[model samples]
Target: MTEVRGVVATGKGKPVEVTTIHVPDPGPGEAVVRVQACGVCHTDLHYREGGISDEYPFLLGHEVAGVVDAVGEGVQDVAAGDFVVLNWRAVCGSCRACRRGRPQYCFDTRNATQPMTLPDGTPLSPALGIGGFAEKTLVHAGQCTKVDPAARPAVVGLLGCGVMAGIGAAVNTGGAGPGDSVAVIGCGGVGNGSIAGAHLAGVRKIIAVDTDPAKLDWARRFGATHTVNATDHDTVQAVRELTDGNGADLVIDAVGVPQTYTQAFYARDLAGTVVLVGVPSPDMRLELPLLDVFARGGALKSSWYGDCLPERDFPMLTELHHQGRLPLEEFVTEEIPLDDVEGAFEKMQAGAVLRSVVAF
Candidate 1:
């Protein structure tokens, strides 16, 4: 086992601490990653609050960019020196979803069999099976997706989660295309990414909706043709007004609340698509009229990890970033040290940052 310094959330609502932890050497189908940078996502905060589960002593951090340090006996896809983006979905090929050729929805995902432990030998549950807020982390070989080494770790790491989810929501799930009109609710990193993805897919009009004007300004940078202040205007009505009395060709809900979802449902044109990419809590529920569901005459889809095939999506996105076609770097609002995760989380909750990356 390799000893490393890592951040740990010991209990619900308690402050996270920097502590020494043990990372075991790769076993079969596993690999050790020497982390370069990791992004502080809302999901990490959720995990800390026990919103995810009762897993205590949680090793937190998921969106990560790292270099392989060791490979297990059976690992063959990646080598020790390769820079990679860590993904949560380590698809099991034998699962029903994979057998049906939709590995993006792979029901059986793999994680490291080995446990990372605290200094006293208490086993730590790695968040999202990544636990990237450490000098090194162990994961299934399938969790690491090789990206361009030249790409900035802080920027590329965001692609591992939120950014990927947003981009894939538009391009892959929503099937956004040239001349299509698109509207995205919520102007955070994910929503802005959806706007960027829609632009990349050649969408003619992109409307960004948010209560915060600052985020709307940020949305414009990502190619939003129009902005809606949700606090002052009705989102669905504004979207319709922008799209010439017909709703947008596609409407994506990046805010996972029932209200935003309802707006998305009403903001799409007849036969248009509605993609929900934001995550919701178990207690949250949506009740839509069955008659309206049938009258909408369109598809209501949920995008998990942006419906992405990591092998295909990660490399292509990295190339786009390298070519200056994608604004991956713009999503990184700040870079903090590993010890500043708590402060970064505050900034994230206050909407002061799109992404605060932890650099090891």
Candidate 2:
């Protein structure tokens, strides 16, 4: 067993603890990663607040950039010293989705067979099956996707979740393309990422809607051609006005609330798509007119991890960042140590920063 320090959520609605844990040696089909940096995602905060489930002590943190330290007997795709980005999706090829040639909608994903534990041998539930907020983590070999070694760990790691999910909501799920007019509601990390993705795809007009003026200004920095302060304007009306009195070709509800979802639904042109990428609480419900749902004449979809295939996206997006096409650096607001995760979560709640990455 290899000893490492990691963050843990000991109970529901409790503060996270940074404690020592034992990570077992890589078993068959597993790899040990020396975590370089992990992003302080809202999901980690959710796990701490008991929003995810009752699994405790839950090992928190998931968005990770690391280097391979060891690999098990069956691992060949990645090896020691290889820099990689950790992902939760380790597609099982035999799943029905894979057999149908749509591995992106993979039904069966992988995790380590052996468990990392507390010093006394109590098993711990690694957050999102990754538990990247540590010096080292054990994962299935397929979870590691080798990306360009030149990319900065702090910035690139965000792509492992929020950023990729936003981009995928636009490009993949929404089918946003050149000549498309796109409107994104909620200009947070994910929403800004959608704006950037729309710009990268050559969308002619990109409209950003948010209640906070600061977030709207930040959205403009990424690629929003038009900004609508939702506090002072009707979101749907603003979006339609920005799209020349009709509506956008693609509307993304990155906020995931009922009001924002309704705005996204009505803010689209005829046959335009609406992509819901924001996470909603289990109790949340959407009450829409059944006739409107049928008359909308377009797709209403949800993007999971932005429908991303890490093996294909990480390397390509890294290259885009290197070429100065994608403004990835804009996402890193600060870099904090592992212990500052609690403080980071506070800031995340306040919307004071886009991301506060933990650098190991």
Candidate 2, residues 1-360, lDDT tens digits: the string is: 899999999998788899999999999999999999999988888889888888789898899999999999989999999999999888898999999998899999999999999999989999889999999999999999999999999988888888888888888888888899999999989999999899999999999999888899889998999999988999888888888889999999998889899989999998889999999988899999999999889888989888988999989999999999999999899999999998999999999998899998
lDDT of 1 by residue, 1-360 (tens): 999999999999999999999999999999999999999999999999999999899999999999999999989999899999999998999999999999999999999998999878899999999999999999999999999899989999998899999999999999999989999999898899899999888899999999999999999999999999999999989999999999999999999999999999999999999999988888999999999999989899999999998889999999998898999999999999999999998998999999999998
Best by lDDT: 1
Worst 10 residues of 2 by lDDT: 235-244
Q: What residue pairs are clashing in model 1? A: none
**Global fold similarity of model 2 (TM-score):** 0.99
Model 2: lDDT of residue 275: 94
What candidate 2 gets wrong by more than 4 Å, as runs, is none
